[model samples]
Target: MSNQVCAPALAIRRCCSDDVHHMLPLMRQLRYPTTPSVLKERLTMLEGHEQLCSLVAEVDGVVVGTIFLKQHQTHDMMKPVTSITALVVDEKHRGTGIGKRLLLEAETWGKERGSSQMFVSVAGDNNITSKSFYEYSGFTCTGYRLSKPLA
Candidate 1:
């Protein structure tokens, strides 16, 4: 007895709701809060806004990875920047270059949008593996966080 299978060639493209269902699970795997209600709100936001951007990675018409980018402007009035809020790839596809493609695509998208910088906020604890990935992908840690008490 044996199992047989075929791997589909991966392709990357702009996202649509059809890809959202698959993207949600990958989001959850990364500890991103996800529920029908939350996902619905996100999908609605994506559909209703031009400022929101997401890219999907597909294999044989199935979404296997995603990167979510939100455009933002500084209060000082400077060139727009993009915040990379989430990026995930199916566990089975990890390390196969799909995640890398999604990130590079995000950077390219930022460039196209005239973003002065791309930013991401991540937990402070060191996860060497994760840190290595970010560094390998050309992100640097700036080591700054500001907090102030609200009266």
Candidate 2:
């Protein structure tokens, strides 16, 4: 006999202001540290933006993952592109397909908005796990993302 524990049902939906408390820790896990108030403000701002799509994955009413996508048109691009600004799955649920589901939802959201391509920026060069996951999900590294801080 095979004995395998089943994972709880996952629910992915547009993030709302009330989700700040639940999403804060996930954001911290992704290296974005902020207070609940600040996170609430950010979530409110995202809610007011027409080009932004923020989604959260919930399991048994607890937020376990989130993805933030933005749609924009560049000077060089003929069609709008959807950029994945943030994606994080709780450490305990990392390998259970939450991230992938969130990503797929983001893609659907983008496509519904007429976006022709999807893009994501990985912060560090050595983040092999993230790179591998994206690659496995059909994303290819296109170019380097360089940043310079302003004084």
Candidate 3:
């Protein structure tokens, strides 16, 4: 991907139903393609699900980064835990604080909702830059995630 950055005037907020129009393109950049119709439906569902939060960072009305956070309850932890299901920033806008800002929004939401822990699962083969970003952002390695394809 080319490093084509949009202008740097950022506005971060909870994603509204109408924001799906701007978000679909950004989601495509994340390699998860979807149509506006499908995205709108998903966003509507997400809005109603208290366990989920969908946030976006926009620069001059263009989405640059997105974060999908989910609240989790585990028997081992008395307090709820926040998990990052998805986090992505446009290739053009990397190195900017947009990604961090979006993440902080999720973290703040989690804390306000009584979360005791927060975590994000990253694939082992994923880019080091992303792993480094999580580490630099105060995340520590806890364990590995193993997967096997079933036939």
Candidate 4:
């Protein structure tokens, strides 16, 4: 996808190495487990990767939001599926449409990748912060995501 200016102050575009230093901190803000080396490794892997899509939302040259995605085929489905692995808008920038624009862009990206479904999972059952946002964005509660640690 190309860079798009959604508002006079907001621009959304693909993430690049130049964004690494800025993005690492943002990920940490969301409590993502990452260090500079790990973040750089992940970013390098995403470079030229066909199934990967990562983006940043900038407000006047300052990075304020980020989203990462992956497109892949599954045995249970015919068309490819796009999973929203991570999405976080700066707390100060919330309620300002950054997340919504990112989501719309993600849908467009998924469609371009021939995906039939766009999926995302909030971290825990008791977490409702992002639930309403996803629901408002047209995501339905198909089922719950259950997990157990074997270790």
Candidate 5:
């Protein structure tokens, strides 16, 4: 048989607590609402879950990006779906394939864990770059969010 293979452009791995420090700056740069303490807490929670996948993209011993996928327990007419959250890449490394790598890793993890669909929440008009990125990455815009202040 001929050798046919698929390889990622960057190294992707499951993230550990040790990666929190490196990931913090990237998270902040992406304007995620998680503080360091909150991040640490979330990591701890993930460590205890069998259904959560936290992945990191690395280059030469440095962590450049992260993605988190959690399988939702809620069933939509008895069908399962996974929620993808907190995809972050350093600003300097944004378009260099790191984010994409992290996303692919997370999707693979979710698919392997029995999820048929992936979902992410994007701020309606605030994150143009992220909207473009998700669309470019092959996710269709399937929903919307609307809110009004309770004053």
Candidate 6:
């Protein structure tokens, strides 16, 4: 007889203000540290925008993954582009397809919003895993993202 346990059901939905507490740890994993109040305020601001889509993945009702997608148009681009600003899955759920599901959902959201392309920026040359993941998901190395800190 097989002894494998069934995986919990995953629910993907819009993130609510109450999800801030659960999202803090996930944000920390992505290297963005902030207090609950700060995170909540940021989330609220994002929610007020129609071009932003913030989603959360919950397993057995516990939030375990998140993705924030934004749609924008630039002077050089003819059509709008959807940018994935943040994507993070819980450490324990890293290899469980949660991140991919979040990405797929983001793509759907973008397509429905008339976006012609999807974009994501991966910082740090050492983050090979993130780069590989995005590449595997059909993203190519288009160009470098240059930045300089301003005081």
Summing lDDT over every window of 10 consecutive residues in candidate 4, give the lowest-scoring window: 121-130
What lDDT is reached at residue 13 by model 2?
94
What is the Cα-based lDDT of residue 37 in candidate 1? 65
Q: What is the lDDT of residue 25 in candidate 3?
A: 73
Which candidate model has the greater lDDT, 1 or 2?
A: 2
Q: In each prediction, how many residue pairs overlap at the backbone (N, C-alpha, C within less than 3 A)?
A: 0, 0, 0, 0, 0, 0
Candidate 5 residue runs with Cα over 4 Å from true position: 1-9, 33-35, 124-126, 147-151
lDDT of each: 0.80, 0.90, 0.86, 0.88, 0.79, 0.91
TM-scores of all candidate predictions against the true structure: 0.80, 0.92, 0.86, 0.89, 0.81, 0.92
Candidate 3 displacement at residue 78 in angstroms: 0.7
Q: Model 5 over residues 23-79: C-alpha lDDT tens digits?
A: 789877766777777888778777758878788888766888888888876745365
Q: What would the per-residue lDDT of candidate 4 be over residues 1-151, giving only the tens digit for each residue?
A: 9897675588888887667888987897778788888888888888778899898999989999999999999999999999999899988889999999999998988999899999998875425978889999999878887889999
Better of 1 and 5 by TM-score: 5
Residues 45-147, candidate 2, lDDT per residue (tens digit)?
Answer: 8886889979999998899999999999999988899999989999999999899999999999989988999999887643789989999999999987799
Per-residue C-alpha lDDT of model 3 across residues 1-151, encoded as one tens digit per residue:
9999775588888887788877877787767778889999988888767899999898887877889999989999999999998888888888888888988899899999999988988874455877899999999988886888998
Where does model 1 exceed 4 Å of error?
1-7, 124-126, 144-151
> How much does candidate 6 score in TM-score?
0.92
Cα error, residue 19 of model 3, in Å, equals 1.8
Query: Candidate 2 — which pairs collide?
Result: none
